[model samples]
Target: MPFLLAAALCSVLVSVLLKLARRLEVDVGQAIAWNYVVAAAASMLVFAPAPSALHAATAAWPALVGLGLLLPTIFLALAGSVRHAGIVRSDVAQRLSLLISLLAAFVLFGEPLSAAKGWGMAAGLAALTGLMWRPSKGAISGGAAGWIYPLLVFLGFGVIDVLFKRVASAGVPLGAALLAMFVLALLVSLVLQGWRLARGTARLGARSLAAGLLLGLLNFGNILCYLRAHQALPGRPALVFSGMSLGVVALGALAGMVVFRERLSRINLAGLALAVLAIVLLARG
Candidate 1:
């Protein structure tokens, strides 16, 4: 239970750090690239993964490669979503990704859906619809792209989670797999940032490096805590998963409102309420 709480806290802290990064004028792309370096290093130190057991011919190389590419991509989208949609909505959208994962489980894996899960899916879908609906007539900075970023966050994260499930199914050690994925993502980020640096589009500096280090620590903490929760809970995976999701949404909303002074529309508030209920139901299911 303590592990679960810690994981939830770490999860929200990632969003908070991203919000702070924007305020501090940190280069998010460069920061994220550096973050992967820190995360990969941390993973290596803590898990001490053996590369011999994770050979390309036997391991889930394709999935690992895909996750390596997708991690940074979704991370950038998540930052954009938090910037444009407010952390309250962005966090809710992210938690609600369980809906997509559940659907995929039913369709792709032939998992049986319980009545509670069905109801939860319905409520979650409604919540997502409400959260994304913009009744106000003011123009956001990136037009529809700004508003759509949350949905992208929702879908992208769901896909990532689904792919991770595939990794688990492939008999790969998660720690080792994560180590490889983080290293790959770090390489990808470095190459992209290097290109941008060459074109005079971005500069590598101390502030971004510091922010990335902090972000990396929190991000790794989130994963470590979550894995610990799973270890502690053993057979109660649903409990840990639901608790993390709900905890992040509730705490993220409070932080956004109190610290950031983010305002949410009535529809968004309703969606938030429905999201909590849906997660509760899904957890029970």
Candidate 2:
């Protein structure tokens, strides 16, 4: 429970930091790139993952590479969603991505459907519609463009979750898999940033470096605590899952409202409520 709490806190803190990064003039791309470096280093140090096991033939290269590409991309999307949609909506969108993952399970992997899952999916779709609604003009914020980020955040995380599930099913060691993915992600991020730097489109700054380092620590803490939670509750992953999902939504809403003064309409709040219920249902399923 302590581990689960810590993971939830760290997850929300990541969004808060990213929200602040804009105000602090931090280069998000640079920070995210450097974040991978820090995360990879921390993962290697803490897990002591065997490098020999990462050989191309032994490792799940395709899934690892896919996650590597998706991680930074979805991270950027998360930041964007936090900025435009507020942490409340962004966090809900992220957690509700379980819906998409469940869908993928049914479709791609042919996982059996249950009554709980059916109800959860129905509620989750409604939650998405409600969360994305902006009361001001009967449309989502950022016009069509603004809505894309959160939608992407939702879909992107779901896709990443699916990949992780596949990797886990293949009997890959979690630590080694994470290490490989983070290292690959760092390389991919560097290449993208390098291109931007050459084009004079982005500049790396000291603030970006510092923020990236901090973000890396928080990000790693989130993963560490989450894994610990699973370790603590070996047979009941659903408890950890529900705890994490609910904790983030509740805390994120409070933080966005109190610390950031972000506003949410009644419909948005309703969506958040439904999201929480949906997560509970999915956990039961």
Q: For every candidate structure, what is the RMSD over all alpha carbons to the true structure, in angstroms?
A: 1.6, 1.6
List model 1 lDDT by residue over 1-285, tens digit each. 899889989989889888787789899998899899899999999999888758743657877888999999899999999888778778898899998889999998899999999999999999998777776553233467656899999999899888888888888887798898899899889888999999999988899999999989989999999999999989998899888988999899999999998766787789889999999999999
Please report, as a residue range, the 10-residue window in candidate 1 with the lowest summed lDDT.
137-146
- Predicted candidate 1, C-alpha RMSD: 1.6
Candidate 1 ranges with C-alpha deviation above 4 Å: 56-59, 137-142
Estimate, for each residue in 111-197, the C-alpha lDDT of model 2 and write its tens digit. Answer: 999999899999999999988886656433576545677799899999999999878876777888899889989999999899999
Candidate 2 minimal-lDDT segment of 10 residues: 138-147
Best by lDDT: 2
Residue pairs in clash, model 1: none
Q: Would you list the clashing residue pairs of candidate 2? A: none
Error of 1 at 77 (Å): 0.2
Name model 2 segments beyond 4 Å from true: 56-59, 137-141
**Whole-model alpha-carbon lDDT for candidate 1:** 0.88
lDDT of each: 0.88, 0.89
How do all models score by TM-score?
Answer: 0.96, 0.96
